[model samples]
Target: MPTPDTRRALFARGTWPEASRIAAVLRLETVGGALLLVATALALVWANLPGGTYEEVRELHLGPAALGLDLSLEHWAADGLLAIFFFIAGLELKREFVAGDLRDPRAAALPIAAAVGGMAVPALIYVAVVSASPSAPAGAATGWAIPTATDIAFALGVLAVVGSHLPSALRTFLLTLAVVDDLLAITVIAVFYTSDLAPVPLLLALVPLALFTLAVQRRVRTWWVLLPLALLTWGLVHASGIHATVAGVLLGLVVPVVRSQAAGGPDAGPGLAEHFEHRWRPLSAGFAVPVFALLSAGVVIGGAAGLADALSDPVALGVIAGLVVGKPVGILATTFVLAKLTRAELDPSLRWVDVAGVAVLAGMGFTVSLLIGSLAFGQGTPAAEHVTLGVLLGSTAAALLAGVLLLHRNKVYRAIEAEELVDEDEDGIPDVYQR
Candidate 1:
């Protein structure tokens, strides 16, 4: 066994190029996160307005009925638009594992384990909380997975805002954690939530999926060539009673993460994955996700009393507890135990408190939580309404708490940074080393 001093620490900063790319992505997502909040706020305001217009608009239906494509505006937002979001997530996941920091199994293990613990504990909390409630509706336990997701945009946006001087490792860890969380969330939805599975459409979906895969592998970048194939796959998956978002992940996974050998090897340049991400991420973040939030977030809060009643419901309480309490506890405990067992330490610059704060930040499960809420309890039902309210409350509380903690941590890091700069200046070492 390696001595304690020799054992590598967890959360050490990754390579400079990777950090640079992550920073750029963070910058873009911060704006997307702001838009997400604005859209959600608008939804809440519109839903609570005196008239029932929000519901009517959300229920407005369009599309061809012949292909089973006719769906409500709300359904489109959930099933169609959110597929774009998942596609971006899938691309990120593939890049991370294939070419990013998580390529090494040892490096991947920590975040993967953390993600699992983070998910499992919240599910257990939800189950326990609802099980103990005599008044909990029959299917309340179905929402156990609701708090398991971490909204990458929201969490990263908060970090970018509050932790300007914090270490890059924390940001990297959170991003990786959320990626793994998304994969697990997708799994849970496909396995637990799917009902009335139709094998024929699912089998048929592979035809277009295979064609799309071959085209992308051969470096086909034509939107016209790929778009129809992708749409057909999505439609078939939807008809299979599997969430259409699964098709997005499938499509993203097949995209090349590095340039082909014929194109001068992996080091030649960015690959199709990066190319597609650059092209589609803005659309997914700026349009698809925000529009989905606008359509999904509206819930009628009758008044303070109404809000209180919703809070009092066991299911709502369970979600709040899972997000607010379970996330941090599960994450921190898992990380601590892993560090101990592996005889590893945190990176010199990181502290348990820093991990705690980030763990709390992970509790901001907005987008996927809402999606799962609709799936668990049929959309627009009273149960779903309470769930929306719960998710909002829990996420808001988590963001506020994490904000306060990280802001303080950022100040400390700032002071340390200043001291380092002063030392570097006195020593006459070039500032390029800071990069």
Candidate 2:
């Protein structure tokens, strides 16, 4: 780390291409998560044993009852800890809207539309399944929304480890699409997953959020002042019965953003947002995500002895279908038909075939998807467990297929083939090299 004065100089300048810099910093969030996936796997497996799940989580002694709101420890974690995740998600959303990929109307349209289609189709399929069997289960019907999400950080983490076998265009496309998918997932959670709110605390929660917004408009740069507000908002929401994660999103939206850069200095107006992300974001994304994965993704190897019985359930089956079949088909089919109909092509450097393969990878929705599932099914049921299995299997299969396709050169990668120095005969083989 640089000296304080030096850092302050850098801070005051704000001349950094902060987006790229933050990208590098935020990369740790994903990489650490990837590193933690193994431990998470072990913990999950251990937890599924008779006493294993019980072993992993330590409950906090909070209110067993509020005036109108009551919460136990798990409720707090699921509702509270996860709110931080959503807050980060909101930050990602705001950044994308401000200067990120979604800033471009034309370039952004395809992914936005594709994400919408991807989310809608999966949800519809799930609803139809539920309608066909009205008595499916309590959590089962609610779980339709779970498969509609795409966890960008986890997916991109896998891609980063695999390196540049994939074209830049495909990566950008997948990232933009995943962000849109995340937004949709959040709305579904806030609207569909919540129960009757205790208005007193809910109103109280908004107080600091409103003040926080005002502070940003007033250009208050220090993040320390917001700590008390963060606590108050969190407590208010916890009592409010809305998923506390909504607070994260609200705070993210109010984060300070500058209109433009200083003439030639590095110090500019990203002060609070930049500082918060630098410290808190890495902790949340790096540590929090993995902890969540360990807590949620643990599959009981032996505990699942009767899993086949559970797997046969329609809720489970629909989740498998939605992420495995529905996501890719929805994403690729829409993109393909739209591009062909409109005669719209991707950047000449990208192959539609390659993009299709990445679309498969985009279906890997581990973290946020599980968060929604946890919210949808607060108490573990056979159906909830099975749905989790479907997400794992489906996401794994999709990621593997996409990775394999992207790892090596494929003749089907039409766009890549477009740029070549080959003199080919009618049979499409280079005449000079063929003989």
Best-fitting candidate, scored by lDDT: 1
For each candidate, what is the lDDT?
Answer: 0.89, 0.69
Candidate 1 Cα deviation (angstroms), residue 279: 0.4
RMSD (CA, Å), candidate 2 to true, equals 6.0
> Which candidate number would show the highest TM-score if scored against the true structure?
1
Please give, for residues 104-161, the per-residue lDDT of candidate 1 as tens digits.
7676666777888899898899999999999999899999999888999899999988
Residue-level lDDT of model 2, residues 1-435, one tens digit each, is 788888777765664557446645655735654645674577656766686544346333466454433544445555666667777777777777877778887677777877987887777787777668755776567788877888777677766655344457777888789888878877787788789878988888888888878876565656687777876787787667677777888887787644435644545546455555655666666556666665666655444555776566677677767877778888888877777787456655566676677677777877777777777776465566767777787778877877776665343333344655457788886643210
Candidate 1 stretches with Cα past 4 Å from truth are 1-27, 260-268, 343-345, 421-435
Clashing pairs in 1: none
**Residue 303, model 2: Cα distance from true site in angstroms:** 5.4
